[model samples]
Target chain A: MNIFAPVGRAFFTLLAQIGRLTMFLVEVVSSCFRPPIYWYHIGQQMMRIGYFSLPVVGLTAFFTGGALALQIYLGGNRYGAEAIVPQIVVLGITRELGPVIAGLMVAGRVAAAIAAEIGTMRVTEQIDALTTLATNPIKYLVVPRLIAAVVTMPILVAIGDSIGVMGGYIVSTQSLGFSSGIYLKNTLDFMKNEDVISGLYKAAAFGFIIALMGCYNGFNSKGGAQGVGAATTNAVVTASILILAANYFLTSILFAK
Target chain B: MTTPKIELRGVKKRFGPKVVLDGIDLVINPGESLVVIGGSGTGKSVTIKCVLGILRPDEGKIFVDGEEVTHINGRARDKVLRKFGMLFQGAALFDSLTVWENVAFGLIQGRGMGRRQARDIAVEKLAKVGLGSEVINLSPSELSGGMQKRVGLARAIAADPDIIFFDEPTTGLDPIMADIINDLIVDTVKDVGATTLSITHDMASARKIADRIAMLYKGKIIWHGPVSEIDNSGNPYVDQFIHGRAEGPIKMEVRG
Candidate 1:
């Protein structure tokens, strides 16, 4: 009986946390549709969450695309089917590597930043002051980030797809003895619009998850510097996990026959 | 006979199993300066938070100008909040914004005023707080502690609110600086003619700024009176608190 008590408490705590997160999500989504949307803040966040993320997202996708091409070529060598490298690289980069890598990287960068910034505001009484000053913290703080991430994520993923395919093209034409024109042709011909569109859809969902987790953890952070540190760590960890989990579910749903 | 500017009726609040504000009833007339004094963790801050709608009371009602405002939120609460300005304990200036921008935040974000007009008003308010335009472009972090508090004071009064709150307005400054801040607060509240509520453990500040003083103890307003009558209140708790003594009915909670 005594042993079961701790388990029961832990279960209840998890349920409470889920309930709180769900409420926060509903509040943020509702606030997004309300009037007085801060266009300036949205533009600022887009620059931060999307434009600034390009370098890191592009670099990660490029390296991953090159590595995927190498691995696929080697695997195809065993079966005497190395001719399939360009086609597979194009398919894999468009469908999986671009969205997933970009999502995870942006989650690490943007989510951590949002959490740290908002967490500092929370501990310092700025949030309460906002309330007193007739400003809604959710509308002023959370909604802009949510809107920017949702609107800019697909653009980021699209650019990542192009850069990733180019990475595979460079690797294939330069290192794998494949001709540039034929490899480009194979890459272009093998890619379908559905693959790219599906990844973009996944990217949009990942963006929402990243912003939601970041804002939620930051809003609820207590104490001081230590509390903010915990919130930042939690934002990154939760955003990454949710992106992967959401990716799996989205893949099954989007691709199911 | 006129309705009280602010009223808290049997308001109560608690967190988890630890009760912070058990029950409180307080009032301030229009254009009056009321200060709440209590030792650390006696719920002085929570009382102001309850009225400002920053924290919802678990029970009872709050009224501003004779209208019930308890439990109101969203735009309705924002409407009520329009009447308020507050100087926080640590100033709480937005570090991301320059000094003028921090002061102008309420005007621009709340009233939808243009940036240029707001900046002019911010400059004007900063002048009232004894800060010059030289500090306008610098971040809050660049200013000294006393200067930050002044900027915070400027921000608070920027909108010309009908009510103002001062939360420990002189916590971390030198004695001379604290006196200067107290004088600024007195002058600004007078100029704005706003009903003022201040909470502090600084007895000197309370004495200087309060027309009426209330002492909170164990989550209740145990004693309250005009500032002149505070010395003759005949309450042992008030006596111990004002003289800054540890030996009295109020025992320090020493946790091992």
Candidate 2:
């Protein structure tokens, strides 16, 4: 037996998967431009992916912000720079933690749900039923989810950013004994509009990744219950990883100057 | 001669090392019901899927109304598909939609009809399937298997399609319910005057609804004839299959 045979097979399998995903992505994008946009489905998905996700994303960002404040205070006290806590906290929350945390959290919540739903449809032959009815599955399923996620993530991230800053403010003013006005002033003065905007940009990319991964995994799922379970798990894991990976690249590009 | 409603010639499909359909050839005349009977994993479903363009054949040609459809795509494929309707083995109703919505789905989504108009027609179709107006608003999951099959039948015939495909129309129901469904299928198909191609291993269903019966074994049609001729086709395979005998030329692949 050739030792390289298994390695070559795995490589080819990976390549084939990449090719399939690329094709799926192209189909989804093109379908977005076609007629019968299904605005009702898009609105429903927005409510599910965005509106319902508000509390989770907000809570996550708030806690993250509070923790960052505490950490900054501890680390800054050693350098006698504890007064810089508010400045750094706002910057961190708006520029990095807010979008990334919300993205990852939403990926875990929404991507898994989308995958399981679509994967079940696939296994049950409902997707085939949709096809037989002359409804393009991508247009009916993927495009709505994609549009909802892209349109909603930035808004979700923006809200998350505000909640996160408020969290930092609460922690600093109440626990750290900083004046509320001073804390707010530092937060506002230190944070550039560009920082918040860049985070929203990352959020948009992350949203696309989350919906794309979910739809792709779900659409391709086979077997039965086990397959749907795998699709759900794969959607979350892949979306989370892609969000973080994209965050780094997006950050570098946006903040390069 | 009138053109066959749907025709498959030299159709072949395989997954990896396993060949599922080995050059299948068949024809269904308009308004005739052709049942392709086969055991599980015998490519009966694949054959139907190939004709529906859900699964493309590895090799061969498919014609619908004498128009070549094997390689059609996009709007053209949709146009071809609009001529057909299907009832999946498990009913395959959308849990998200109510029974009436499920029936009207092809009308509203595919044909772009107004929702109220589609719903009205959906209700009318449900009534034809012997479902009351009450069940129209209920979700599919709330219905029993037999009811779901009725709803599926309603959906299949809702659009008044030119050709309908039934994939194991009676697989998961009681014998009485199965017979009921079979009768309903015959009545509905007659009402619409639609050609049909059904795949099932159920002899009872095949006998009741099929004008012609085709037996698929080991990836090919072994025998096909009028339902009246199925019992005496003189093919041992068909005899053994219809009789449900374990000992025959067709051996079961049982392993301990």
Candidate 3:
């Protein structure tokens, strides 16, 4: 009977995990304001999490945009609504695909890196060393990373949104035999600032979520390399799920009608 | 005659069915160097972690300087932690930071000291550990195991803390390097007059550095006494561990 209770326990565990995430956010915010700001460490964190993450985010968006263009143009000819292809590609790439796909890729890359790096530090006592020096690890390690993700993810997303939209345009005009002038006009006419803004907001939130999940799992990691591996895997999976869920919530709020 | 700097009472920790740190009780006098000796995975590290609040024990209490530290928080916890300096099992210096930066990590980040002042102190601390200023700009990865330990030692004494912890400080170093580290430990502790607790599997390192020694077995301190009495501690577990014998009352937990 006890062995069969995993299903029930899992549900409660999920509830508990969400609670922990909320607690983590609050704890981090509270600690952020306290003394002992580690600016240099923050810069180092920005380098690791933000600057190093551009390549993966860029590639994911470009490919996704290119694929979207091909799919939309192919489907449009069935109803002779070929003019709608450009508009659809722009709207889809900017609003949904860009942020979501970029997020998933960065989440996989950044979250796992943060987790493994911090998890190793946790076991090796670097985190403890900070404490003994009277330096707060939450400030030195977690806060800088959280701040970096919050700031960088939006930038990555903005670039991703443009690149993704361009990817679709390239495929439509060059590969799929569409007139460049007409395709560009349709894309411009249908796109709005609100759509891009919403995507950036989502990207920022997703970045925070990625760093948060990674640092939380990493800081709490135990048992050495095996613990680091588990944290990395968990960060990717959890960040992906959370991004999707947050996307739904953001969309509903942004377009209530 | 000095007060006990670290005191643990009935400290017990367990992970699911696995019991670790079963009712560990000990007291370390101020300015004394104490070594905890045991085979690998015998809860020596767990005992130290319990004292540091890294892992909370399922039962028991820990106190530092007559103040209960196991459950304190906020500025109080921060204040308590300021008294400690630890050299991790590995040096654990930040790969992201230079050697001087790693050594000055606490002074600059924790205490909010100015960069120039912290750097000066970091340089001085490095010199104390026999590392020249030339080594300061290099990252920790550039250093060998022995040099890294020296950097770790520099970081530990950088803040001149009241207590210092060394976790397997000499495990990976060669015998000569191990002796050098022990000598550094002795000299540094003498210079700072800080209480020290270390966990090690190496008897020669323990013998060279410890003023007192304790042997951990089956999750408790099986024997504790002045360093001079370790050979005659009259505990077979201590005997087997220090002597490095294959057969004893202790059995390995091998799956084979």
Candidate 4:
């Protein structure tokens, strides 16, 4: 075998995958602009992706916020900066932990579900059936999920942010012996609207990543049960990785001095 | 002379190093049922898919209603597809949708019919396939294999399409259910006055439903004749296939 054959093959395979994904993204974006928007389907997806995902996202954010407070308290104690817990906790939860944690959680929940559902549809020819029935599968399947995730993720994250902040406040005042009024005052004083807004922006981007990865994997899935299962796992893993990667770039862009 | 309802001229398709269809040419006259019979992996499905525009042929032309449809896409493809209906091997019903909704899906989604009116038409079509009103509201997942095939047939004829394609319609069913489905397909095609192109390995299904039969071997139509003449076609491949013989001119690919 040629020394460079394997490398060349791998490189071309990567390029081909990128090309296919770009085309898929273009189709999805183009379809979104077209008419016959299925508002009913969109609403249903919002319920599935946004509403049903709430408790998990909320619970994750709550625990994260509480743990963050405890950690900050312990670490700050070494420097006689224990009182900084409220400000740091609020800032961390709003600006980073809240959106990222909720995103990962929903990536695990919603992205896997979307991939499994659509992948099964593909293997079973229901997607083809949709095409034969005159319904564009992208319009009926991908667009609704895409629109719902983009619209609802920020809302979900915003709610999660609130719950997270509340968790921090409760843990600090109740267990850390911090005064409730002082903690609230410090949290509000330390946090800028931009911090919260940036997180919401990240939430929206993460939502798009999750839905795109899921739909892309699912639509391209072949074979049968094994294919669907692989698609589901791939969707969650790829979406979670993309969320984190996008978060870094978004953070730099949004918060650069 | 009127043009054949659907015609394939020297169509060819390949997947990587493997060639699924080398060169295929066939025709189905208006309102006639043509069954393309072949063993597994003979590109029978590929032939139907090429004509349906699901898979594009690398060479040659496909004409539906005398119009060249080889390279059509977008809205033009949809317009071409509107004249066609298909029942896939596994019924392919939407598990999310109820039986009636599956039947009326094309009407509502494709033709812009209101749900209520589409539902009414769906019920009527379902009844034609001997399904009662009670089954209409049930999900396809709730139905038996035979019942799902009936629903599939109902959905196929729901739009009264100009052409219909059946891809192994009797697959995964008991022999009795298979015969029942074959009878229903014959009756429904007659009711709609639709041309049909079906592909199956089952000789019984081919005999019962085909007006004209074509045998696809190695991606080429090796034999084509009227159903009555299939018995005396004198093609060893056809004889071996119909008789389900393991030892014949057509060798089965098996490993010890």
Model 3 chain A: weakest 10-residue lDDT segment is A128-137
List, residue by residue over A1-257, the lDDT tens digit for candidate 3. Answer: 58759988899998988898789889898988886566766888778777787888788888888998888777888888766878888888778888888889888888988899889888877887776676678887899888888888888888888888888888888888889998888888889999888888888899889989999899878887898889889888988999999999988987788
- What TM-score do all the candidates reach, one by one? 0.98, 0.98, 0.91, 0.98
- The candidate 1 chain B region of ten consecutive residues with least summed lDDT is B247-256
Tens-place lDDT per residue, model 1, A90-146, is: 788778889999999999999999999999999999999888878999999999999
Instruction: Give the docking tier of candidate 2.
Output: high
DockQ of each: 0.89, 0.92, 0.66, 0.77
Cα displacement (Å) at residue B127, model 2: 1.1
User: For residues A69-129, could you state the per-residue lDDT of candidate 2 as single tens digits?
Assistant: 9999999999899999998998998899999999999999999999999999999999999
Candidate 2 residue A86 C-alpha distance from true site, Å:
1.1
Candidate 4 lDDT tens digits, B1-256: 8899999999999997888898899989998999999989889988887887778999999999999999998788889889989998989999988999999999999999999999999999999999999999899989999999999999988999999999999999999999999999999999999999999999999999999999999889999999999989999999998889988998765641
Q: On a 0 to 1 DockQ scale, where is model 1?
A: 0.89
Question: What lDDT does candidate 4 reach at residue A171?
Answer: 92
| Tens digit of per-residue lDDT, candidate 3, span B148-203 | 99999999998899999999989988889999999999999999999999999999
Q: Each prediction's Cα lDDT score?
A: 0.94, 0.94, 0.87, 0.93
Q: Write the per-residue lDDT of candidate 2 for residues B207-235, one digit (tens) a residue.
A: 99999999999899999999999999999
Off by over 4 Å in 4: A1-3, B254-256
Q: What is model 3's interface RMSD?
A: 1.5
Which wins on TM-score, candidate 2 or candidate 4? Answer: 2
Q: Could you give me the TM-score of model 1 versus the true structure?
A: 0.98
**Per-prediction fnat values?**
0.88, 0.90, 0.78, 0.65
